[model samples]
Target chain A: MNDTRQFHLLAGLATGRDARSDDAIYQSLWEAIVEHRLSPGARLPEDALAGAFGVSRTMIRRVLQRLALEQLVTLRTHRGAQITSPTPSEARDVFRARRLLEGALLTEVVGNIKPADLQALAQIADQEHHASREQAIRLSARFHTRLMAMAGNASLSEALSQLISRTSLIIAVYGRGQAGCPCEHHTLIKLLETHDLAALQKWMHEHLTGIEASLDFTASGDALPDFEHLFGHHREQNAS
Target chain B: MNDTRQFHLLAGLATGRDARSDDAIYQSLWEAIVEHRLSPGARLPEDALAGAFGVSRTMIRRVLQRLALEQLVTLRTHRGAQITSPTPSEARDVFRARRLLEGALLTEVVGNIKPADLQALAQIADQEHHASREQAIRLSARFHTRLMAMAGNASLSEALSQLISRTSLIIAVYGRGQAGCPCEHHTLIKLLETHDLAALQKWMHEHLTGIEASLDFTASGDALPDFEHLFGHHREQNAS
Candidate 1:
């Protein structure tokens, strides 16, 4: 059940392509991290993973690269790959960008929402409110995904969803999930139902801020000095 | 010389990765379209490209997927991938998103601007102003990139850069290259040099609006009805 559930997330990334097995492998590795099977600072050796997944190192590296772009996996020199543990600074930046993005998305979509879309969103809100703590977090993330999907831009949808995914990982290590409540989702729905844009903006800003506040940013970082190796000596000189 | 020149663009995407070959392949395809050697509606067959690049279908597919993500390539079922000719709606949506994102990037970085960053940016502005029309367009795009990099969020910079890349393609197929002028770049630099956020915001909005105005959105789009194929029967039901 656990393995299958994890493949489900990978399937989201690979629905239409003719590469189900490859997608499965990518998601499997991703899921391992999501489930904490792959611990936060542990290195992912290409040879072992390639053998385990019955694929070439090239295939494993492909998945690792995709994950790295999402900031979920950090690829290191000679060191192979590791489950990314974002530094406090990185985490705050992600949250700030998401806040800006989600705010823009909400402003864009709230004006054009259809009745059926609202109905579906309401159902997701209900699921988010009633689900178990772990499931609730996933459902809550899905709420934002559903909202972004309504904007009708493929790239925007993908970008916002990836940000949500990374935010979930951030919350996993630094979260105080207890800070979230169904009342927050309900109020958002109410504002949406009324089509009150100002209220909607206020609610979302507060909601996102509350989430950001819940993260324990004081945790010490566990990042490798991979950027220096990736760019070499000249990168520092060129740094803005 | 041509091959070497193309890698310069790919270097933007591959600054951190170890795979020069993969980056080269991606930029080659990108430049082909950029130079109008491949028309907007041209098909990019995987097998032919794999042979041309002397790489596996997997490698070629990876490059194609990344391009598709950038909206430069459209992946079609049974028909393989083709260069994406975004519809008026898609083009407008992209411009809208870019306006929001670049505006946000400007807002985020304006408070943090340094003298050195401004000086380096002034060099890019000069390049944009004095270069040949072709090189000037590239430099103008680079100016925006250098501006965003100052914000210090790798993901945000990449996401915004990819959006700018797509916007460049949109302009290439539909633009009047003569529409851009040095006065605009100088105005932006003047605003930046003074740290006048309000004027900076106004100049960027008008600047982007001018670029968007130059595009012939009336150019009939050559998009396939492949969204239905990719999303299945229910996409229309849920369509916003």
Candidate 2:
């Protein structure tokens, strides 16, 4: 499989434009974990990743540490890091937190959005509408994040960004849908343009509810991969 | 000055309710910076801090790195670390961020608070009213943080907590008031208890406005102590 091509595909979706190596790597790894390409309990060895990316261990370590801090990767005592694989309860908690934070942010923005801000959002929605399935999915996710950024709260924006990233990861792992439907975005933009606060709030609440309802949380029962072999190169481990 | 006693005094105000070496070191240095005990542009040497804390240099380094990440302390390229005196633009951004994020969170909590939650909030408000001036200020801060917590958004709560802490630090340096009164808390709690969403939002907006109004940003032209020397003992640098 062409990992790099797959990464580019995901990265293009995330940014609505071509992304650099660091962002591509980060987004690719993030999506892989969320989509179960890198399943929970799978190891991520720095040296192996460095070799794969043709980058320094230092760069890979920085990205890994960032993920670890987000609680998407668990850094064990001496065992190295693995995908978080949030428990059912943690997954529920994540959504609950999102509902409170993002929902409130959306409501506030609905009341205060400027025409210029709406224009920017419309541009993103238009881009999503025309993108490929994966690109569309990525843009759909970024839409809400971009809205948070526009709200002008760095702290809130940072937290929401993390949550949104994690949510994408969760959807990648468990989502079962056509990735590129811009229907929700269309509705949201219309509400914003009209300055209908009540309608906007209702639409946002339903949108999140729809997203949450779409997850397939039933255990897939897929066989777990070998951690050492998956993380360390198969040939390298055998040669050693 | 009894450093340990001073440590205890500040530690009592921090969330832990117990003063460990690291917490003591963090609180003391944080206060020193916020209180202008350690002025901006002063250097902090590890060896000096180690001697002052009666701990190893490793401990000092860890604390310094954490503060650097929070942007409370600046780790210069070759010049070493010092308290971060935020630029005027940065300071304005912080307040702007706070108003948008906290204002939204408060509005949501007010609209959605339950009777049980109101009771808990009342208890905290009562405690704030009866506590010491310093304790009251801390408790009042906690009351807002607790509201975020009850809203059940971990991400929002964490972000707001960090912002509140940084704001408190900023206020310590630039605010005219030496102590925070309980009047605001009382008013906020009353609004929450009444379950009047419109009134609650108004109260929160005004409360934050009042806080921003109290800041004295003009330079006092007071000669401040060296930041490095406040945490660093003169003997240790000479010994080294």
TM-score each candidate. Answer: 0.78, 0.65
TM-score of 2: 0.65
lDDT measured at residue A133 in model 2 versus the true structure, 0 to 100: 64
lDDT by residue (A1-240, candidate 2, tens digit) is 323443333334344543235555677677666444565666777666665665676656657766876777887767887777665455666676677667667655765678788788888899887877655766776788888776665656777777776776666666776453487787787777787767766777777777878887775422354466457787786899
Q: Which docking category, incorrect, acceptable, medium or high, applies to candidate 1?
A: acceptable
Model 2: per-residue lDDT, tens digit, B23-68?
Answer: 5778777665544455555567776666556667666766786677
The lDDT of model 2 is 0.66
Q: What is the per-residue lDDT of model 1 for residues A151-221, given as tens digits with 9 covering 90 to 100?
A: 77766777777777777677766875463556677777778888878888788888888888888865544
Q: In terms of TM-score, which candidate is strongest? A: 1
RMSD of 2: 12.0
Off by over 4 Å in 2: A1-40, A50-62, A103-123, A126-135, A177-180, A217-240, B1-71, B74-81, B86-139, B183-203, B217-240
Query: Could you give me the TM-score of model 1 versus the true structure?
Result: 0.78
TM-score of chain A of 2: 0.74
Residue A24, candidate 2: Cα error in Å is: 8.7
Clashing pairs in 2: A34-A173
